[model samples]
Target chain A: MAVFVDLNISHTVDKKRLQNIIETAAHLGYSTVAINHVVDLQQKKQEIGKPKCVSELFDQFPIVQGKSRPIKVLNRLTLVVSEASHFRPTNEFKSYDVVAVFPKTEKLFHAACMSFDVDIICIAVTEKQPFYFKRPPVNGAIDRGVFFEISYVPAIKDSTMRRYTISNSLSLMETCKGKNVIVSSGAEKPLELRGPYDIANLGLLFGLSEGDAKAAVSTNCRAVLLHGETRKTALGIIHTMKKIEPTAERREEEEAPVLKRARTEAV
Target chain B: MVRFKSRYLLCELCVSDQSSLQLLDDRAVFTGVRGAVCRAHGDYGAALCSVSFAVKYLNADTGVVFLRCRKSHYRILWSALPFITHLENRGQKVPCAFNCLYVGGTIRTCQKFLIRYNIQQLHRMLPHCHNEAERLEVRRAVLNCSLKSLEKEEEEDE
Candidate 1:
């Protein structure tokens, strides 16, 4: 039940806006916040270049020719997020409470290179595009170190809740899962996203077995969201998430398990 | 991949004619785009690709025939198979499923893919035809052969 604040859509990525949102999210005691990229995937990568310092140069222009996983731009954002986590902020943000996302799937794959080991979040589409990079930012990514996942819906609009669609996507999900992949919302904005139980319910309505639905939402999504980045980068993650803090004790009632109502495969 | 729960007929008149004549087994694989979407290529929104397709019959003058495809892939398939143009003509004796693609059991996008960029697996399938009548017959034959063989295999396994 993580609440992702959409940084991808906001007009500003400047310090003021970022800090303000972080403080709000932290004070709200949300366990995690996805730094969503609002624009089209490619543009977001170009905004951030290759990582600086030491042995590796991710900005291999020749290597990252295509817009999707251009070497340098992809690597740069990994460093940026890693560095940004250490950015000096207001007392609340400095508490190291939020994890950032480049919001670009291509950059995410590259960021997961040797420099960083994070999952690339993708959106599910009828069409397929190359989301994995050849030379990842890290070494073990291809063989189960780095993870990836896509946000999916039963149908976007006017589409029927067909089993083939689910089966096909599920097949793809299964295939990717074999490669250390995770499933995600790839949600454009918050309103478009459903919580864990909501996603699980969607699975049930779409012909998935109860086990599959539970795995898709509860296990699959939680595993992706509660990643190492979510764990290591944030200073007060467990402290804020745990009932240990006096300020967060008020969330006890809200922590009730989500309602088990079934969600239709399509809206 | 995309799929539709509803079954679509390639040709209503041809379907009734064929089955009654014992030319068809009432067994068929109708191909068409389901839950289709059309959009511009990128943020620039420069051009548009209308993603639509369905199964169809081709070279109407000669005989009965059908084919499956996606509208977005029409250009590629048309270029690959010369007879595709003849099928595109409205007055031709055969029509085609230009609006969709059928692969295996479910209707799907004709576009192919692998697990990732670096992998070497193909994810989609498409039909090839030269004329309307030829195309329809080919589509029918493909479905019939595949279904009959599958049934035989199932019977054998049982």
Candidate 2:
């Protein structure tokens, strides 16, 4: 079975609290989690900065429940783009493992769906969805492997946001038919985080079928991670890494035996 | 003859403070689950959950609970369990979350699963024991459970 991944754990500056949240996530059986750094370009003087080194957060990563392995933590950058000019693909975006966009306008939403070099598109959960999720754009996003993220923290915090979350997700499901959707905690506090199975069940409440609901928490999130990796590679299909050079001592030792064998064969 | 089937949900109430677990009762958990079902699935779910729904067992010390519901409406209850962020008791909200461990068709199966689960937990706890006394206590607990199960099986064989 595909391990559970919560791709959006709201980034907080408090180191202790962040560690607590990650520990809770590991205890709750999340194999992987991403610390989300959101940059709202609507605010003046907003600049995309390099993400902090993820290793500095924990001395020893907590082992995931039933997995017997330490949990993997990744950094994600979410750009809140209000205008076309707000989203600029920069070097800083490459520093994060996953990139996402939260579009405010219909035009921006379309752009995010069809052309944005982003892994996740954040669906508005705290407020009502301003634009309808047209089938064309929603299908385009699914085709491109761009996932729609619905954060459940707001839904748990208040009834109004819960209404908005359910309605927006239902409409999105209508257009996308529950494909390429990931449900994340967006949890700043430990209490806000729910287990993967719980979110899978909540997916049913969001109008997803039983299988699709489970996928929303597991396989779909894995696809999103692969999509994010493709951003750094040449079409995710081909990957190239620098070959390590053999040390001089090992090369001399191994080449001598081959040279001796060649000499013996020649003799 | 048609027999009614039931689903038993074995869940653990996870609390930030361990002591807060003692405040939980079966009634509080039932009400909390019912309220959550009403909120998540609305009135229909509430009506479904009300039928043959009950808290079969609660261990306040361990925070383990067994919730019984009709097989037909178990999904509604299972889905709503995550929404129960806390249980209200005596006007004081005990902050907790229900972690459903297993859903079995019968209480017998649930009990058998819980026994295996507790043994696994004991095994996990064995290495964490600080002193010899704690280690022996864990070993005794593990052996005692197995012995009881063996005795029960011998009785059933007769």
Docking class of 2: acceptable
Candidate 1: Cα lDDT at A47? 35
Best by DockQ: 2
Q: Give the i-RMS of model 1 in Å.
A: 19.9
Q: Quote the lDDT for A60 in model 2.
A: 76
Best by TM-score: 2
The total number of steric clashes, by the backbone 3 Å criterion, in model 2 comes to 0
Candidate 1 C-alpha lDDT tens digits along B1-158: 86533222222121112223222211221211121212101222112212333443332332222333444343233212211111211232222212111222222221111012112111111122446887677558655754466456535632
Model 1 residue A65 CA deviation in Å: 46
Tens digits of lDDT, candidate 2, A1-267: 569999999899999999999998987889999999999999999888888998999877887777678899999999998999878888687688899999999999999999888999999999989999898888899888899999998998787888999999999998889888999999988877887887888888899998998898899889989888876555554443433665655665665555445534543
lDDT of 1 at B39: 14
Model 1 chain B lDDT-worst window of ten? B117-126
